[model samples]
Target chain A: AAGVIQSPRHLIKEKRETATLKCYPIPRHDTVYWYQQGPGQDPQFLISFYEKMQSDKGSIPDRFSAQQFSDYHSELNMSSLELGDSALYFCASSLDKGTGGTDTQYFGPGTRLTVL
Target chain B: AQSVTQLDSHVSVSEGTPVLLRCNYSSSYSPSLFWYVQHPNKGLQLLLKYTSAATLVKGINGFEAEFKKSETSFHLTKPSAHMSDAAEYFCVVTPPGYSSASKIIFGSGTRLSIRP
Candidate 1:
């Protein structure tokens, strides 16, 4: 079975640099969610999209922005990155009650972002 | 407001011993709950979920969770522990009024370590 795909499995950048992480949800999945996991921390919900539209927002910082493309892929763009931004970024996808009665998300191998 | 709590920060068990990871949730109404596991450098995997349906949810790899409304608990359990099951487990809760856009909240995560 196809799983979600994430780009730049590992990234290192200096403080104040900019970075972008991309996610490709599983085929036919209409909902995408982004999460961040700090060192030794649980993943935290950042934002989500449905049908190419921003559907929900969580504790995402103002310097961070994300969007889903027409092809159902999503991107998280970060600017003026801080050292605290270092973490594992994960992307998950699920069908919004389309077939499966439940919207259980499938996650991708996360992108590890390290801001120096 | 809704929140999910993982009672333990870490748990250790011997191989073939019973496994249990405690979770508690608070929600004004019936809530959607989930258990996700992540191995080192791996993505999150959905172990099981409770969506106002059956209380007993059987997931892949012999993992199961029971939703007890009276206790407001949804603990993941397995009859026996395996070295391969050593990982981080997260309890999640989706607040009421879920839509394609709602973001799921994750617990602080509990690290499960298995001894040979």
Candidate 2:
């Protein structure tokens, strides 16, 4: 089975620049999620896209946004990046709504973004 | 609201020794619990999940977790520690009042260290 795929394993940008990350879900899977992991911390949920619609978002700032296309791919956009935004971004995909059942998530290799 | 707490920031175990990572969760409803592992420079990999099916859930790489409702704990265990198991482990819980599509809450994470 194909796992989730993320592009640009590493990225470096300056403050006020825009950063975009892409993700491709597993074949035939819906429900894609984006998370941010800082140094020595847990991954925080950024946003989720399900069935080509924005589903939910965690405690991300307004500079962050996401879009889903055709239910199989998604993009996370960070406008006007800040130093605090530097972190590893992870993309994950699940089969269904994941309603307290066996629907587990598969993750991508993650993209490390650095803001200077 | 839902939250997960990993009791230890780091755990060290010798090779062939048993390993245990403690996790506690707080949720208003029946919680969906999960354990994910992240190797160096890699993505998050799902080790196991609990969703009201079997209280004891078995995952890949000889890992398992038992969901103890009475203690609000879902601790991961391995009969023996392997060198490859040295990584970061995260305990996750889904939001209490929403469907699986809701955003997930992650623990601070526990780093597993294996000694030869």
Q: Considering every candidate listed, which one attains the maximal lDDT? A: 1
**TM-score of every model?**
0.94, 0.92
Runs off by more than 4 Å, candidate 1: A98-101, B100-103
Candidate 2 chain A weakest ten by summed lDDT:
A95-104
**Predicted candidate 1, C-alpha RMSD:** 1.7
| Tens digit of per-residue lDDT, candidate 1, span A1-116 | 99999998999999999999999999999889998989898887899998898888888999999999999999999999999999999999988765553567789999999999
Fraction of true A-B contacts recovered by candidate 1 = 0.69
State the C-alpha lDDT per candidate: 0.90, 0.88
In CAPRI terms, where does candidate 1 land?
medium
